[model samples]
Target chain A: MKKLMITLLAALVAVVTVSAEVPAGVKGKKLRMALVKEWGTGTHMIMHINGAKSEAAKYGIDLSVIDANHNLAKMAEGIENAVINKMDAILISHGKADALTGAVKKALQAGIPVIVFDNDFAVDEKTANGKLVSMDQYDLMMGLLSQMALVQALDGKGNVIYNRVANVPPTDKRHRIWEGAILPTYTGIKVVNTIDLGTSNPMPKAQTALETLLTTSNNIDAVYAVWDEYAKGFYNAIVASGKKIPLFSVDISDQDLAMMQTHPEVWKASAAVNPSLVGRVQIRLALKALAGERIPRYYSMTPILVKSADLPKERVSMKDLAKLYPAWGSSDAFVEPWMSTLKK
Target chain B: MRQEERRLTTKKLDIFGFFYKYGTILVTIGALLYFSLTLDNFLNFNNVTNIFRSVSIVALIGLAITISLTIDGFDLSVGATAGFAAVIAAKFMVIWGYGVVPAVIAPLLVGVVIGLFNAFLIIKIGIQDMLATLSMMFLLTGISVTFQDGSAIYNFMPIPGGGIAEHTMSKAFLAIGQGKWLGIPIPVYVMLVVALLVHIFLNYTKYGRYLYMIGGNQEAAKLSGIKINRYKLIAYVMSGFLSALAGVVLAARLGSGEVDAGAPYLMDGVAAAFVGFSVLGTGKPNAFGTLLGALLMGILLNGLVMMSFPYYSQDIVKGIVLLLALGLTYYKMKHKG
Candidate 1:
């Protein structure tokens, strides 16, 4: 009876010890994670959250979320809070460089590993500061595709309105790439209106600015938005105004793809970033670190150019959309489905 | 003795009737109930803090419009003025490396200059308020674009050999945008302070009494020895100063001046200021009523976002709600009259 009791006690202790699996992705004994600004920009956040949740499962790790909501002050506070909470790792996506350094320093002081995704605040990608896991290479792809689209629509020469997202690093860098590649290549292309549509809520203001431009002159031959969201609004105003200007933009969301297929005036083409791949890679690297393995300072995610013509024929049917993107299954999702309701 | 008792009962009824005249209390209660039940994260500290942080700028801008609405004149240039002030603040901070106090105050002074210009155009040049302010909006936007080189001014990048003090100080400064005061956002407290002061200045003081009387009947107030044009000019200056102050807060929140950061405020200000009509009663714009208006809209936005509703659909919902609120208020007024 005593021997049997000892064995049973040992088994119970083993079960308790093995419950917290040093997850597949976490290299260290524990897991640490952080995300900044998760509201207003719902589409971006949802994609990120989906990736985070999936990776967290593969690696039995605890994830800490901080919604900066695009405020620099609060974002700093969030970073401080995460450090104080004794997180193992830190990740950030921020617009301003100065606002993020303090948080980065705090995390560093706490002896935690930090990885920056989406935007590099103070880290150098080529050096050994911290890995900048990003889709910036996609911007270069955007620049190339934008030029091709512009060329195809304008016949290599005409006035165009570059509805750009100014101040943002990737967007601004993409513009430089576009300018270096396109402006010198196509001399006949008269870049008439280089409107900096600003960063946040670029769409409505861009649409209004476009409408104003149209009223003043009919010389605008094409519209090029830096991102898919801005493209949606610009295309809407163009279609609604009964104008036949060819609209081109980068970044392919499912809605963007649907819009491209249906909008007669919009020739939508975007370089796609496989967020699933990014999530998998990020988790793997983080796990390696936890496991006391040396990893590269920076990792790059490759992007693919996705045209409307090259998309999957299996459209997310009304029935299956619920399973595929459950966030869109809500009744409220259909409220602003204008972007996807294009009847081609 | 029976008649005396009946008279006392009627007096009690009169007090209740007058007190319940404004239906803002009902709307507040409805907002509280709806947010509590609908938002999964509504009760959490994180979400509540987010709400206050986001609402501060709108509240300040709304108050500016509320002041103007009381005088039967609206400021369209307020939004552009905000953008211009933001750029100026960025310029002072980043380009000139000025001290924080000077960086903040310089932009506000420019606002005063623009406001004076606007008041001059309306009061002296005989331009209509709406048309004149609209032109000024266009002009100020042009100035901001020109100064910013058609791009946003990001002043927060680290300098060589500079310690982390630059970054820390800037973050500290930005905390003033929506920092907490006694567990409430600093902007909310600031709004309360400014609103109370303005309310007293407009309602309790003789100058305020004259200002409202002018709105009620301008010619009669002028005939009764009120300095009509002078008071109107002061109102414009006051609107300008508040708009400028709001701009500083926004700059801290946004952390930079993009080309058109303040575009939404133009329409939001109008919507919120006019919402005061349906707040306390039609044809009145009170400080308390403006706060209620901003709060109602803030709650609506928070609830909608929490429910995962798209941001664009908010316009349609707002329009519908505005129509309903105004319709109900008009119905009640008709019944009362």
Candidate 2:
């Protein structure tokens, strides 16, 4: 009877340990993750949420989300709720970070690990509480190199308008990369004008920004906007300007791809990310953080440059989008002991 | 009380009396309940506060339109005036190194100037109010875009020359956009105060009474020896000032100066003002009713968003709701006439 009791007690303890959702050395424990987004110009929000969800399923996690729809007050509320609920972890993306400083600080003090992507704030990315990441340096390099090639195509000499909101950190880094990696090599190209797209919707904002630029200046050799929507503005502006110029940018939307496919001469190329992959990467980071694994203070997404010639024939068909930019659609398995170590 | 008075009081609770008294409020409550039930998290305190905050800007703009419609006149350039004021205020903070006082005051002055321009074209120069204001609308939007060579004004960036002028949007200015008071967004407070003041002015003040009379029937107002043109001038100037005020608040809220920021608000303002007509079957534009209309829109938008409905589809729902409101009020008013 004593031996049977000992065996049964041991089994009960083992079962209890396996069922408990402890953060460290734990797998298959349900993790509650929350995402509060500031804005997503296109399918950016949809893909990002989907990517996080897909990855969460692998980690045995439940995800709840809120979108601010560009309201700072609404965005701030989300952070407050996440902190108040004492969530396992929170991820925030793509918004003015200054507004959420107080709420995010509260979350950090509450011992909730926060993972931020593209939302650099007053705090250093290297924190015990969280990590801040950007698009991969490799992706920045790809975007710069593509810009260089386009400049070279113009015989290393033309009026290049830095059309993106260059002051923004994400675009700022790419601008630095362009200056450091590409511009010094080809001194012939000059930045004639820089577009200041304030806070309008990217579509109309870009169009108006470029249209205004067309009035005083002419002889633009090429335009480089930070994203595909910014590039679309250039395409529309160039059409309105009654002038044709090659346009280069990063980000590939269905609209961007369609425009690039039809107006190849104007909408030249873009450095595109597999948004779904980006989402998965962010979730992987969150999961890793939850598991007490030390992650890099910062990480960037490595994107691929897809030229007009490289895209599929039908930009809007049933054809797989991955075929258009195969380089971006990488499925490199994440190697980690805590990850994929599911409980029996 | 007398028996007759008691009878009248009892009748006040009847269908027509109820509709006349509580129609808009009732519809709004219905919407609130419906959204709270159908959409997850829609009934939460944070979400409800958010809806109010989101509508605050549009509500103020709607208030301005309400005033314009009250005078039997319309201000087509209100949205353009708003956009122009936003860029101007942003430019002051970002480029001119001015304090918040100057930044705000400058837009108000511009609003006065714009009002004078419209008033001149319509009252002095004998242009139809609608046509004149419409012309000013295009001109204002064009000028707003054309200013600074079409690029938006920001703290630091490459200018026309090879040099970069560096500045930061003032912390005080940013606070106006991002600050909260009493657990409520500052914009909501501003909206309420402004709307209430307008309500008092239109309903209680002698100036307001004259303005409403002018809107009701201009010839009768003139026959009563009212300075019709002077009232029209005051009305337009007020409209211009209010439009500029909305612009200033928007700039403060967004933390950046944007071009055409007010462009989208024009439709929203018009919608809210028109929607007010059905509230309580007033069939006329009023501040309180306009705010309520904006509330309806805010609730609808919040509910749709929470349900993960597409942004584009929200417009379809808005159109449908607007059509119902218009059909109800316009049809009822026509029958009564």
Candidate 3:
């Protein structure tokens, strides 16, 4: 009687496994994905995840999603899980490279393709298995654009106050953009002061610093912020102090876009990059590799300026965000999507 | 005979007595002088205003710490409690369309309830103060997140009951955070009143004497017919109440609530308590000394940042200053006769 019951249970399990559809475009195969949580990116992370899920669905791929939640150990665990599950590809939107190195190498040894989005640690422009999904760091683009915006705002000359965050990577990149690119272009745009608002409670700190900056120099024209939150903070201080200042930053949020559309007077402009697009492309590229197609080692997503007048006429709802970008939208990513960020 | 009497009086005065008599005052003056000479922007009116304005929140947190530390109990949850209250106030005022007074009171009342619960855990259940407060900190953080739906609640729209063609809430709110009366920041005035009241309550009142005796020697005070647990609970409750008040003031100042808000004050409050011990050789918590300590930390950080040091490094310097203050306390205590 025990043997007969065990036989019945085994047959049921096999039937259930075979009932699920194999993802399209691939050779009747399943795919696993890992997402790294970058806090402050917010809804964009969800978009990226949705893109991956949608792409997997389109290509006959079963994508297993794992979220790192901005922790390195958790990310590594995701990578390990992907390897153990025999996933076809791994997608990582990392802030630091060192945090995910071991897991990437382990996945590589297991014959899995790793496509890193946004950030990485390798200097050789290659992945753990010598395949590269991204060649250039967005920080470089962010820095170049930030400097150009500052120079233009300054009219090629004035005191530029740089409000920087300590112990963060992108901020360090922005600083480089200020020192390496922006400062050299407009020698007249002298950097009069650089305030470190610290890692935490930057808004109030930036406000207090701006109040002091107003007293220090009447020649200040532009301010550069690494993130939208930090930019908004400095902008708030500038507004509260009643100073006419041009503020620029890297990532743009729904609130930022909405604010730009209605209240353009407050924020001048922001260089916006879509992580959702990156997620979609990362999944597509990973699928192509699984299908034995030659894909580019490095895929670059150019940064675009999303100004007040150019807000998207056709806005994507939070629920359908995954339909737009399948990978980012799946799992718990579905919610009040127009505003809240999905990544962190 | 007169010469001998004068000589005897002069001989009795010792080094510890002189140092203790003028420690906090001397340190404050010395700090001001040192910053004035070294820092380029130290003397500017704008810088001075900025420094005082920034110090207000820390001053409030320091007061919160003082209440707990006086009874020889510690609160690791004050910072988390402040953050929780900020988010709660933001949610009520902005999302629910509540009046500002109700919004502000809601967080404070929540704080009082939390303080009461903390007292219950310690006084009734006999849990240790540090462990109880730490557990409460984690609980409040989860509660704050749940209340806010794990997102920032921003209210940038102007208040509906506008009269003066400006954000009446902004202007009225700004008064508590940024307003000045006779050139002193409003929060500073609030801190001053709180400090004076707490000083009177802790020193002059008979209940205050019992609190001190309980802290000095709990067994002896209990034997002397003191209700030890009741006063201890009161100390913690006051800590919670002040922490919540600080949270509301911070929300008013920032005009929003962040999940990670009120983090820096956790360490800053602890530093203030240790610093008060070294002030005037009090070797214990005192209102004026904690005020000086809070200001001292504020000035040190403000001056260091102005001097172009990174914020991370300022943390290390703060730790060193705290250690030095502890050393001073130990030295004073060891030699006290």
Best by DockQ: 3
Q: Against the true structure, candidate 3 has what lDDT?
A: 0.68
Better of 2 and 3 by DockQ: 3
lDDT of 3 by residue, B198-261 (tens): 8898889886777788889989999999999889888888889889988887877776776657
Q: Candidate 1: what's its TM-score on chain B?
A: 0.86
- For each candidate, what's the DockQ? 0.02, 0.02, 0.28
Better of 2 and 3 by lDDT: 2
What fraction of the true interface does each of the listed models get right, in terms of native contacts kept? 0.00, 0.00, 0.24
Best-fitting candidate, measured by TM-score? 3
Candidate 1, lDDT over the whole model: 0.62
| Cα lDDT for residue A21, candidate 2 | 34
Model 3 docking tier (incorrect/acceptable/medium/high): acceptable
Whole-model Cα lDDT of every candidate shown, in order: 0.62, 0.71, 0.68
Model 2 TM-score on chain A: 0.83
> Candidates sorted by TM-score, descending order?
3, 2, 1
Q: Which stretches of candidate 2 lie over 4 Å from their true place?
A: A1-344, B1-21
TM-score of each: 0.49, 0.52, 0.81
Collision pairs in model 1:
A25-A287, A26-A287, A27-A287, A27-A290, A27-A291, A28-A290, A28-A291, A37-A68
* Candidate 3 Cα errors over 4 Å, as ranges: A1-30, A38-90, A98-100, A123-127, A131-137, A216-218, A255-263, A278-298, A308-344, B1-27, B156-171, B335-337
B13-118 per-residue lDDT for model 1 (tens digits):
6764443345555766777688778645465664565555556666677777776666678788888888788778776776566767887889889888888998
Model 3 chain B is weakest, by summed lDDT over 10 consecutive residues, at B159-168
Each model's TM-score for chain A is 0.76, 0.83, 0.74
